[model samples]
Target: MTAKKIGVAILFIVGAGVAYAETPSSLITGYTAEAARATPGFAPSAERGQSLFMRKWGVSKTMPSCATCHSDQPTAEGKHVVTSKRIAPLSPAVNPKRFTNLAKVEKWFGRNCKEVVGRECSAAEKADFIQFVSKGSQI
Candidate 1:
């Protein structure tokens, strides 16, 4: 193949790869409209949730920001070293079972927060996080 032809082929491949990389925000926004409805007084704020996810909390030594493990974009698939179970995708677009039950939600937040942040997340924090995840779509 000509050098110029090879270069063009490479460019096409790279472009295709870039197009396939979905944005985390876009993924989060795919939940059903019903899922987006807040319960009682709690409302989800994407901005606040984003801030909380990015903030560093917990014991200074052991605690890391959610972004540390989940990735800043929260789009990467994770593997639980202990359970050997794959961490479910945070994006509603990819995971249809994301917000079907309150019990499961609390259970995960409790475990994940304690494991990653060294403490349980506050109710407000949990609400904010949920709101953020549920925003722009139905959960």
Candidate 2:
């Protein structure tokens, strides 16, 4: 293939990868809408987000909360309490790629919330959690 064609192909692939990952604000907006639909006058609160992050729900003794994997300090890297896998910092200030992909975000939240909270997180909970993660990452 011509060098020009190869370059274009590479660019297309890269762009496609980024296409679904919108800004953190956009993701929060979407979650907010979903939350509002479920319950009118709902709003995302960072304080609620922090509470969800820190509270030990006792769902998993090993992975008690988001703090188990994400740590109370979002800027700090955490290792999985279960698998011992090194987890990346969730803070956007430290990791530019945080909260970029809609699908990846939902996928992990679905898995992690079930594992930690013992059920799928509601949209309100998701918004609060995301608002926390997004704000924490910034700082």
lDDT of 1: 0.53
State the displacement of the C-alpha of residue 126, model 1, in Å, after optimal TM-score superposition.
1.4
Candidate 2 lDDT over 31-89, as tens digits, reads 77767866898999988888888888899988898887887788889999878999998
Write down the TM-score for model 1: 0.53
lDDT (tens digit, per residue) of candidate 1 on 20-97: 433333222322222244344444467777787777776444336666555555455655444555666565555656
Weakest ten-residue segment in model 1 by summed lDDT: 26-35
| Best candidate (score: TM-score) | 2
Instruction: State the weakest 10-residue window (summed lDDT) of model 2.
Output: 4-13
TM-score of each: 0.53, 0.81
**In candidate 2, how many Å is residue 59 off?**
1.2
Q: Residue 126's C-alpha lDDT in candidate 2?
A: 73
Which pairs clash inside model 2? 91-137, 92-137
